[model samples]
Target: METGIRSLRRRWAAPLAALAAWTAAALPVAAIAAQNTITIVVASSPGTGPDILARTVSQQWAAKSGTAAVVDNRPGASGNIGADHVARSRPDGSTLLMAATTFATNAAVNRTLPYDPVKDFAPIALLGTGTLALAVPPSFPAETLKQFVARAKAAPGTINYGSPGNGTPQHLAMELFKQEAHIDLFHVPFKSAGGAVNDLAGGHVSAMIVPLHTIQPLVQGGKLRVLAVMSAERAPSMPQVPTFREEGYDQVQVDVWYGLLAPAGTPDAVVRKLNAEANEALKNKDVVASLAKVGIEPAGGTPARMADTLALELKRWPPVVRAANITAD
Candidate 1:
């Protein structure tokens, strides 16, 4: 009996030893997870606003955390594809989504999505929010919101405006303008905001409501005219331009935002670490200056605040879309 017991113990010893060693190795790796790679996926093409913000902020995160960070661009389907991808990713801090205002707006309108914007994603922080500038070519007849409204009202369907895509912030912005000012105009869609702004500068489109940073140079170069801004207050970069609210069109107020999010079920420790890194990134002076150059202001806040903001926007866009009869292609 003693010989048999010794044989059995010898057979089990190797397997048990291997299991112990594996667990020991994994514990250190898991404990040091704060230094792991954090991947941020943006739902737009490179050089776009979100893409720029993600890359810029990621550099700061990497510097602060002493780890490499990646920014992936997955542009298409009005941000649904990328958003869905992040939502379905492992609930690890390694996979994150750099969500913009579209997350809430999409949720407001779309009845079918692969994942729940609110439930399937954990909000990390609100990075920044800024307004879109409504610009027309220098050759166009309007230079102010009232003038533009007058032109559209006088010409009706003859007036044409361009947007990044249907149901986008730019699209809804102009739609809100139409509804508030009670004017009829034709809609022109482009693949991207830069494209629309380019066409607007070239006089292919009558007007465009694009991110302020994109057309700031053109506006200064006498190639484009900024009729009005869509923020509640004037953009600091262009304080001379009046806001829609100041122009007596408070209903025309619309602003875009960028935020950070991880897949749902991410460990609280990982989420807190990421949130700390992100907040530090936002506070970096270089990041602040870069954001300001693009008319973006850093807005670092708790996950709960971002979630609240998303919920508010989710509640806001449906009625607007229904009223404007906006549809996705």
Candidate 2:
């Protein structure tokens, strides 16, 4: 009996030893991947809306996934600096890019780009959409959107409007509005939104279109009059305001959205893992509340939907850019 037992133990030992060794080798890899530090690259400077959104979602993702995630600010060349970095990074799940409406806007205006937004990255998830508001000073000559249009036409090229920058979405929105309204307004581009906000509140600028949140405080303080939102409908945060479409200009619906993207060729499983975790993070109550504070509506969707969004934007913005004569500056 003892000899038979020893024979059986010897036969099992080799397979068991091999199994133990395999687990030992795989354990560290699994742990590393699960705990690996991840970075969400924001292609803009700190304190920008996309940077805030990236940091918010990534912090929640880290806490829930047991992995460290951070938003890295890489601002330059209209978000190309950070975007190109992620595009060149290895196809691991460790790095991601904050893909936003500006990415498509940049592509629309600039003919030559360092990387293809669609081909160089995999759309993982959409975090949310940030809406813009169009407003004038409380005492501006125009009381309503139609009146504003009439004023612009009456004094062509004399109305000066401030925006965040030259090629910014705010500037573009006003441009499209001008085109559709058949009016001309002088463009006064600011290096930052705060400057424009101050000028608008002080009545130095005739009109301005900026992020919905940027104008919320001023509008609430009764410093500015919101004419119309550049969306299909009014923002929940400010329902009293009407949409440009509602104001007889339906051609100025511009949506500013932000999404997560992985490097092209990232494994399908890893991409799905990221999408799932991001969606889970978006569902958190605190995350939802934070997005609301910034006037962003949370949008969680499949990778394919995000990809389709980018594809649609690519097709949608070029003609507008050409029509408005927008260019990189």
Candidate 3:
């Protein structure tokens, strides 16, 4: 009887120890789930594109996952402030960055960054892409992209364009357009988009390449005219507008994409959870509508896709920045 009891105890001992180990390993995960409150950091001011996207997605994500979520705007240094905050945050998936096109553009234009765009973050999901349109004051001579190009070529350096600031996507888009069209247009950098658009609508600035929705009000108010959209296809919001490609400037396509990212070393499981939530949020009808209002179309995809997008942006912008001599300051 004693021999049989000893054998049974040995057999049960290993299984009991295994169960205990599994339980110990799972407790932290369970606690994390219970206390999960995601904070999405937007490297821009409130109501900006990135901030809007973050709030729209996070609301749906929180509702779906039963987790609390918030947006923390840290607008400064061309979005590096908020980006650096996320880069240094704990890799527990509780903090994320609502990265915009500047995420890549800043890296390309700036000589040094606080964190490595490629090495410091794990991409979660690509939220959406915003279409860009070339706008001119209603009284400008050019009514079409071809006409605009001809006018610029006829009097190079005479036509001026405005952008929100140096190294912004709008500024870079026009620079790339100038390179492709072989025309020179003076760049008038503004302190903010509001100021730039105000100037553009008031005819103080000749032209600007900004998001379609941004200039929609002015276009509707007859304060500005959209010469051509810089997207590959016509924007759905303004289907009547022609694309640059259609207007014979096939190389002038530029779109601003927004996405989510977490600090490097975040667990695969946590990343997957966040990615799934974000993708789902993109599919929500309300989310789609809200983004569409801002000229953004949903572009939900895998983390790998986001990584590829960032890699491509990083590669694509350096040449343009170099050619344009764009600097963050």
Candidate 4:
């Protein structure tokens, strides 16, 4: 046992020494450069969830550190434009990407991404996560998922579900559900989720999958009935609404998450600093309250954890896309 232990230690000694030397050599300069004005670039339109979270968090970070923090909105190309920009930015940590689900989804479906999704960015911390709710018009006979599936299967294409677009996550999730349940509901595409929800409420569309924040008020007002949530677990705001997993349709898990990342090869110290600050900011009462009011749960965690999440999402979405043959026009 002593010989075996000594042999293992000898095997690890050189790499460990090299790592320690590299870390020691990098820290002094990083410590001095860490406080320079930092800009977080968000790949979202102004007033969108990622933009709001970026602005709020940057303000809190600035106040806490006596430094300047800025949020630059770069919204376009389904969030790839901003993401690609950050992927190519310098690894000095002055520029960070305030990214959303589009980061993973784009990598999942795009055949010609300009940068390596896994190698070109350093995942910093997850900001928050939101789920979509399954809403149907009050006029629909089915109140639960089982009944809804039965009704749709019985009528074939007569029953339809509305989505913002063909290749969007909401559309793909419903398609996965349809395949699993052997139902044949028609898909009705709209310009946006809001438009689909509007028609669902007016009975023009039978049902729609929409984010919880946008539909919670309508659900509370008794305008549209929530059948189930498209999350692995139920959302906190609607704890009474069972998840599709709990309802025996386990394939409907979908969520929109916001997180921060830096160009890959960023100093490990910088990534750690950003992770610590972002997690601390999420605990602030004002920040928590603001996010909760919109149904986004704070999800701050280490860069390693965020990287694991991004990896899983990238693997999860592509099979769905191919199975459904979903392509955007």
Name model 2 segments beyond 4 Å from true. Answer: 1-35
Candidate 4 local lDDT, 34-121, one digit each (tens): 5658889988778877898888898888888765778888977767788889998878678899988777777666778888888899
Displacement of residue 193 (Cα, Å) in model 3 is 0.6
Clashes of 2: 0
Predictions in order: lDDT: 0.83, 0.85, 0.89, 0.83
TM-score against native, each model: 0.87, 0.88, 0.90, 0.87
The runs of at least 3 residues in candidate 4 whose Cα sits more than 4 Å from the true structure, single-residue gaps closed, are 1-34
Error of 1 at 123 (Å): 0.6
Highest TM-score model number: 3
Off by over 4 Å in 3: 1-32
Question: Which prediction has more favorable lDDT, 1 or 3?
Answer: 3
Clashing pairs in 3: none
lDDT per residue (tens digit) for residues 38-91 in model 2: 888999988888988998887897788777887799999888999999999967
Q: Best candidate, lDDT-wise?
A: 3
Measured with C-alpha atoms, the lDDT of residue 281 in candidate 3 is: 90
How large an RMSD does model 3 have?
Answer: 5.7
Residue 250, candidate 1: C-alpha displacement in angstroms: 1.4
All models, RMSD in angstroms: 4.5, 7.4, 5.7, 9.1
Candidate ranking (TM-score, best to worst): 3, 2, 1, 4
